[model samples]
Target chain A: MPSDGITAVKQLFTRLVYSLGRETATRELKWMKQALIASHSPTLAAMLQRRLSGEPLQYILGTTPFGPLDLLTRPPTLIPRPETEDWTLRLADMLTPTPVRPLTVLDLCTGTGCIPLLLCHLWPPGSTRAYGVDISQHAIRLAADNAARCNIPSFQPAPYSQNVFIPVLGDLRDPDVFKRLLPPFDIITANPPYIPKREYDKLPVSVKNYEDPAALLGDPPDSEEQDGLTFYRLISKILRQKGMLRDGSIVALEVGRAQADAVEGILQQSAGLRNTQVWKDPWNVKRVVLARA
Target chain B: MSSPEDIARARQLKELEPLHEAWSNWTHARQSLEETLPLMQDPDPTMRTLASEEFTSLTHTLSTHISTTFPSLLVPPSSTRDLHALLELKAGVGGSEAALFLLDLLRVYVRYAGSVGWRTSIIQSSETESGGMRDAILEIKGEGAYDALRWESGVHRVQRVPATESSGRTHTSTVAVIVLPLSEDAESMSGNDELFKMEDVKVEVMRARGAGGQHVNKTESAVRLTHTPTGITVSMQDERSQHQNKRRAFQVLRARLMDVKLSQDIANRRATRRNLVRTADRSEKIRTYNYAQDRVTDHRIGLSLMNLTSFLEGDGVQDFLDALRRNWQEEVMEDVVGESE
Candidate 1:
């Protein structure tokens, strides 16, 4: 028999499972079934069709899992690259394995508040307060909305439905912005816009068109300096001056592939920075830079 | 005949298609509702209620889209002067030798403004004692004058040889410009009869100096008008007489106040866009003119102009302005459209 919407969805999901590994396939299908019941609309067929047409399943579903948390990812806020999520969980493990003291954390250029919210959820109660700052208001709203959606399941009672994620609006480039934010924390994390203009032009179509130009390119108009490193310089200065981080507080930055050397160079030249270390992503590309001040 | 579980499975399958339809058709349904709004202005109670609800929902979506897409194009007014609404412009910077570079920048803008039939008057200028201006504020009066010049704010560094330095060394210097509309609400067609309240302004008179000739030190011809509430200070020392200086200072102040008000209105219409985005982060180096490379690069848009000699020397500047204007207008329109969605 020719397939019905449910049969087509089933086949499409089977293909999705086959594309992913077996364990993941099983888990995702289980969720997909739940989503089908929850959505209770024929749009699930359209969602399947869109996914089959090469639209990201995340885009169709409108939410994805980040550690134990569910996040809404949309255009400009960057669909939380699984790799970034992996780095987040890794950072969480290193910082909060056995909470010794209350942890103050800052997530800079926090587009969708994904990292900070997860950090809050993973850390021990009252031991961590997370801050997410983004220059884009829509991104902040998306992040705030995601925070709400992720903390409580759709059906949860009203009183318990808060993600408790604090989202601030301001540019990272502004020195005064840090002063208005909550007091400094034990760790500062950011995955800033690092691609040089030329390199940004060559980004895959998925990124070049959908994301904001500021997020894609490091420097825009008159910057003589490599624009990607400007945020790092600003962050390093803010950390040193604000006392947000204790002396020897940790800084973990996710960097572009070839940016390790230049970033390191800036960190070394910068005052009050020390113990700079680089870590590789699962792909073995030098991805994260962990530093202490 | 199907078992109850099989029947439930088929029912689940049937439910999948509508969910898919609902999600995919959301934007389209929203758009159609927007398009049909103007046609349904019925006077009947039930029809009016139905229409009002639909119109409200459509307008909400449009405004939300606008807030999301063009978040920083407008700025709110926290003060009377609306200082945040002023247009930003930058002159190219070079070094000590860059005095000539700044002079060249001044000439380029004055000429470009002239080309558009705009009346340009230098309201206040501080010269480098050696030569050229340390900083200068020029008031251009024309149709769309402030709107045209607002994008130029940022540090301009010029690189070239100075006429005073015999060693033929190139120096870099900087000049910043602020353009404001004559009245916050008035465009080019608006009459210039409207005057700002003098009570809010502090006017001071002093001697005029710089390139204006020998009468520079003798007379109290220079005028400084400070809008106390907004802290927007304007001075006109370039004119020859006190009356002329006062008029120029007031004109500049009016333009600035108007620009601020206009921006405030735009921001009010798109508050989320302005509040979330740093529209007037003028201190951020927006563009740089490199004498070595003969290039002018904008860091915000990543656009670089190779014809530096022509651009800085008061020669072929319209192309750059046109490009910037196109980008800014596009951004503004995007915000408007987004708000309407």
Candidate 2:
């Protein structure tokens, strides 16, 4: 209730309002205040200065909660979106409650290794083998760090079972990237770059400034045009080249708006993936495309 | 065979016949009792003894009729018998002490739900810096959960010295509880168009996304929905999953809207009858938990029980609940008798 306290809160509110709307700014201020109070160290000015400089709150706070796992997020590697968390949980729940066999998952474009880490944590009463591949070494490192920090207890339901999460630096575009992975995986998931280049240029500063452009843009490195369906094409191409997925295994992809049908077609035509289903986010956006090989 | 309408009419007649029979029998018994009363005034010792014995038996039969038969025939079966309850507890009046007591009251309901084999989940909660509860929402699921905890919706006062207090003086802080039926009426409301329309609701997430998919990095997952006309806004940021939060918010909002409509309907229907049923009113102080006396008292039924520890632990609260339910039924029976007279 002090004058300076009022001004400080108002200043923090003003800084957040430009990037996150007025409503969100107020809410975030509340969150920050609570977080500070909870930590028992009320350094409002330091947090305010960091926010005033346009740094994302996740990085400022040093952690973001992804379901049960507290994932560590940093710059350039995409912070895990709530939409992604929503779809991943739904897909994990689709598998039968108890599985006799150990599960193997490969998450492509795995920034901060959130997808594979969560899958590993939530895997059925058996050991898990997960591979998180990203083009950025920083991302791969962060992903590895998250896997270590998550503290998922390894389980053995079979003779040769051990929980192993490997973060590999590899590009999804290259066919050789499949060689780096022990495939015939029970599950393969990707949240590849799906925003077209033209739209990426026009994105909000909060997104365009902090996150890596490669993670946002879906066009090929050498291509001028962009339709945001570049990764969907690459995913299908790699699956065809390697044929490395187990027969009738699951493959799930997070797609852009109105891209489910096209991605469904691309996956179905070549990858021999069937039983295609489009999953919607809370906002009723067709957010995830699921199929079985 | 009778047609469906004919069958319904037959059932109605079957139900009405019992009431008519009960009415006539009740009148006949009263007349016989009255005749016996006049005989008791006569000087004959045998006649007086027989009349007194008849009066005792008649009184016993009429007591059962008042307590059991009339109430069952009068009040309809409760609509909320099967509903899971959503209990909201918020601190009121006093500052930090009230919030702490609110948390204590939350635990009481939660323990009560658990002891009765009901599952309870905290959908949302907030705490003060000193570990006091600001507000909380608990979803209690089980058969007859609402029936058991229906009368719990009101302001509950706790007279206890604050844990942080050095003065050792009893503080009369209050915690308000509002219990709503968590019914699937909300889920079916989307298509029914009876309760509300999806079009009237505007949703705003904390971090808004311009376009879909891997384009943006969004961590702020708080979602707020405002029913524009009524201005009933439900914002959920907890549960760590936007999907779950959204579902919970909608369920809470829809249940609240349904409750408002249901209360109005009940009020209008009961306009002609003398007030028998007590509506859920949070402004009314329904109960008191006095720590000094080690007692819990439900003000509505004037029933009090010692051992506040076990009461808050859910053991002693059952007696108060049963009494409240019985008192309500008796009120209904009295109303029916009054109407017939």
Candidate 3:
């Protein structure tokens, strides 16, 4: 029996697992062993080596379940985080008690269309139409594929109806493109790039190297003191435009660590927007900002 | 006398009662305006301002009644108003140019459906060799899909330089659009099994054509059905299974039958009415898309607007639909008023 080879591989994986912290190491180790057993390929051993070198677990698995959806996870597009999943479910719960009307939702920086897809799944079909916009073409394509794959019920009656999820390729950085968007949306949600420039370097090698730079960083930090708030500013400005934000509509945004206050300030400064509030994540950090128009 | 015609006439008058009430409200507001005009010259400045404001408010109310409430009263209740629509687009003439325009027209509707939250799916399509669509059938499913898209049926002419053309000279191409309301009883009709006599139908199975590769060609998955009485043949090869193809072929056949029945009813109604509404004529060129001028001209209502690109992308088509509905209501009102007289 080649006991040395199995023990050596387990030891290497244990070191890699330890890097993720003791709390997650056991689970990650078990998952890696299960994956290895399932594939039983030498190539998977190479993948394990890559994972040991700090490749994101999502990329290694190729998929992650967000709410009721199994979303395809690929490199370059930001992986669906647990923080996002928590807030999205909370948002859905908030809207579930409301009267059913033809509601329109717009999601900015819709990485994997996770927000819109999950919302559409949670909301009653035919009453909600959700649009997801991302700057990256790859994200847009992947999001569209996910939308098609999910097969969410659309308001369209039988014979010709399709999924209500629409993925648009657009850069929120451009005010002109933002202005061109059709308005009167009932809800707007965003999980934009909010990681500060200084924080990017401090991020684990897995996130810094494997994840998309566009997904993690906002407009180049103007100064050392400036935090990532480029998307929040642009979104707020666009929302302030005449006929952009509908009366009594809600805008929910996922914020970075300790950035909720700044995001709330941005929303409060925007015309017609009020009742800014910050929501804490499961870990008790203020991770989301909610505002009403 | 209480004859059937008299009963119908009385019922119609009762239906018009709401319009009469709106007219009376307008008249009352106008009377108030007349009364306020004299009060505007009152000795007190506050009274004058009050009278002027009253006059402005009354005038606004009167206009709103005429534009919205009055027109809404004129629209005859339609049974097929809530039904989904089957919109078919086919290249009429100008060869590949027409095909290209047909494709663009299809995109316009699809994008428009997306914006409005309506769902659209291509039922069948025959593609031209040049990557243009020769014919396409779309099923637009949503609440009031038929009502919104009913006026879209007609010949749509486009004036643009063809991609195949060497010169920049503008060429005209025509695409015919036919809109039919999907039967509300589609499920029951399909399930009845006895709706169409078996002896009068011919069914054939063949290899599926187009993009499916070796597996598609190897198996006889395509199904074609021909109605012996009407000589209408429908072939569906999109599905991998012959059963699915057969089912789809039957669906198309049923829709066609329903369309024929509805058109006959429309024709009979048209024959009875002396004043013909030219807008309903499918042969008429209802709209013109001029790329050179960046304009879309709807010939029926004389609506010509710039921003052809946006219009083609399904952004401004709602305005056109609204205008068409308004025109239709006005025409129906005229017919009702004439009949009452």
Report chain A TM-scores, every model: 0.79, 0.87, 0.87
**Candidate 1 CAPRI grade:** incorrect
Across residues B162-270, which tens digit of lDDT does each residue of candidate 3 receive? Answer: 9989988899999999887775555231333534666777776553222121001122345688888889898876543344456667777776767777777777887
- If the candidates were sorted by their TM-score against the true structure, best first, what order would they fall in? 2, 3, 1
* Alpha-carbon runs more than 4 Å astray in model 1: A1-34, A42-45, A52-54, A97-100, A152-164, B1-341
lDDT of 1 by residue, A220-280 (tens): 5688876567677776677667557777578888777777777776776774565798886
Encode model 1's per-residue lDDT on B250-326: one tens digit a residue: 66677677667767675785666542323655566666777778888877778888978778665556776677766
TM-score of each: 0.40, 0.59, 0.47
In model 2, which runs have C-alpha deviations exceeding 4 angstroms? Answer: A1-6, A14-22, A37-42, A97-99, A153-163, A173-176, A268-277, B1-86, B89-152, B155-176, B180-208, B219-235, B238-240, B243-341
Q: Write the per-residue lDDT of candidate 2 for residues B198-265, one digit (tens) a residue.
A: 89887776654655456555555777888887898988886544655667788888767767777888
lDDT (Cα atoms) of all candidates against the true structure: 0.62, 0.77, 0.75
Better of 2 and 3 by TM-score: 2
Least well predicted 10-residue stretch by lDDT in candidate 2 chain B: B184-193
Candidate 3 lDDT over A152-241, as tens digits, reads 642233222223777778877566665545677789999888877766776767777887888888656554444788878878877887
Task: Assess the local accuracy of residue B69 in candidate 1 as a C-alpha lDDT between 0 and 100.
Answer: 28
Best candidate (score: DockQ): 2
Clash-forming residue pairs, model 3: A126-A155
Interface RMSD of each candidate, angstroms, one decimal: 31.8, 3.3, 22.3
